[model samples]
Target: MDQAPPRVQLITSDVRQRAVLAGALLEAGFGVLSGPSLEQADLVVVDGALPPSELAAACAQAHAASLPVLMLATSTEAAREGIAAGADEYAIIPCSRQELELRARLALRHARARAPIVAGDLRIDPARHEATLAGRPLALTPTEFRLLSCLASNAGHVVGWQALLREAWQVEGSQGGRQMVKTSIYRLRRKVQRAAPAAVRILTIRGAGYLLAAGSAPPRPPTCR
Candidate 1:
């Protein structure tokens, strides 16, 4: 069976920037759709200069339609605003070609990774899209679900802050200029802690990101390995 090229929708008003980005992506083998509309896109990238009203409207529409959104920012302020407006990811201006490609791939990868929360009794079933802690189901927001899923998938490895944001929030370095990812992480941690016991840890790596020990499951399973 033939595979379809990844679909990317770029919503930049700047013709030159759009042309450059679109051309680069197309050259690298992606199905590029450049426009201002958010409908019919697996990934939506919004320009930083988009008016607040327009940004909010587009975000609401995308969220309602369950489409993942990425924002392109020219400044830190713009990036913060984009995150607040509900963009799933954000890329910044003057991004390097390598960074752009990495971010694009990360966004697409995370998009595919998104699934329903399937967690129970310290077990998370990404395949089943279910999550549970202590034999009980958890009511995690989409963001929290992604955050936990990312941690679960990488088990023993320490996930970097930028990497976690990329995977969980789908936001690359472009839109994650300052505390956007941190704020999300804090919220995610708090939510998880609220539902779990103090001993069940979600360790912070200080200058790094987070870690979730695979066998850290409560009531350690005999066959945890």
Candidate 2:
């Protein structure tokens, strides 16, 4: 069967705004969901007009489930509150369709990167944007974690320099280019070594790019006896 479009859960009290956002998202190739169950949602878009208590609770709940929350704020105050409540992204209300769609695309793309990915004894938990090596935590910054997740997800494949730049830095033609990517990779490897004294297996494929070998698997949850 063909894969379903990435689902987005839209939470808002305003019927008109919900309709607008939903229409824009639908046109942008996303499945619009309206409910409390967020398990399958790639992202959550909520009205910025929500009360602070309500917004904070919603953001916290969504984050706990590894879902990225985007908000439509009515003003700068609302936008700041949205961020304080853990919104991953936000736009002041009355945003252009292009802006909303673009933000959704970026949020979903980044959130998908957070999903748990495994390579060798290394486990990358997208939910928390965290990585564990040999069962020990690696102290990776956000950019490093995102870069590592991108590599780990495509284990055994030479992810090109341009691709890494796009995935990690979200840019195509920055001035630093490949050098920027190389520096990040160097820093990431050093961090990985802190958790696993063994040589970090992320390989630099010269001319081709970077690769994480494919001997990894997601961490399996313990079973009841």
Best by TM-score: 2
Which candidate tops lDDT? 2
| Displacement of the residue 61 alpha carbon in candidate 1, Å | 1.9
| Residues 1-225 of candidate 2: C-alpha lDDT, one tens digit per residue | 998898999888888878888899898888998767998888889888888888898888888888998888889988888988899888876878888888887777777655689777888887666778888888888889888888877766677878889888898957888899899998887777676756346767666787765444332222210
In candidate 2, which residue ranges exceed 4 Å CA deviation? 1-3, 125-130, 138-150, 159-210, 214-225
Q: Rate the local accuracy (lDDT) of all candidates.
A: 0.68, 0.80
lDDT (0-100) at residue 188 of candidate 1? 64
Query: How does model 2 score by TM-score?
Result: 0.68
Collision pairs in model 2: 114-126, 119-216, 120-216
For candidate 2, the C-alpha RMSD (Å) to the true structure equals 7.6
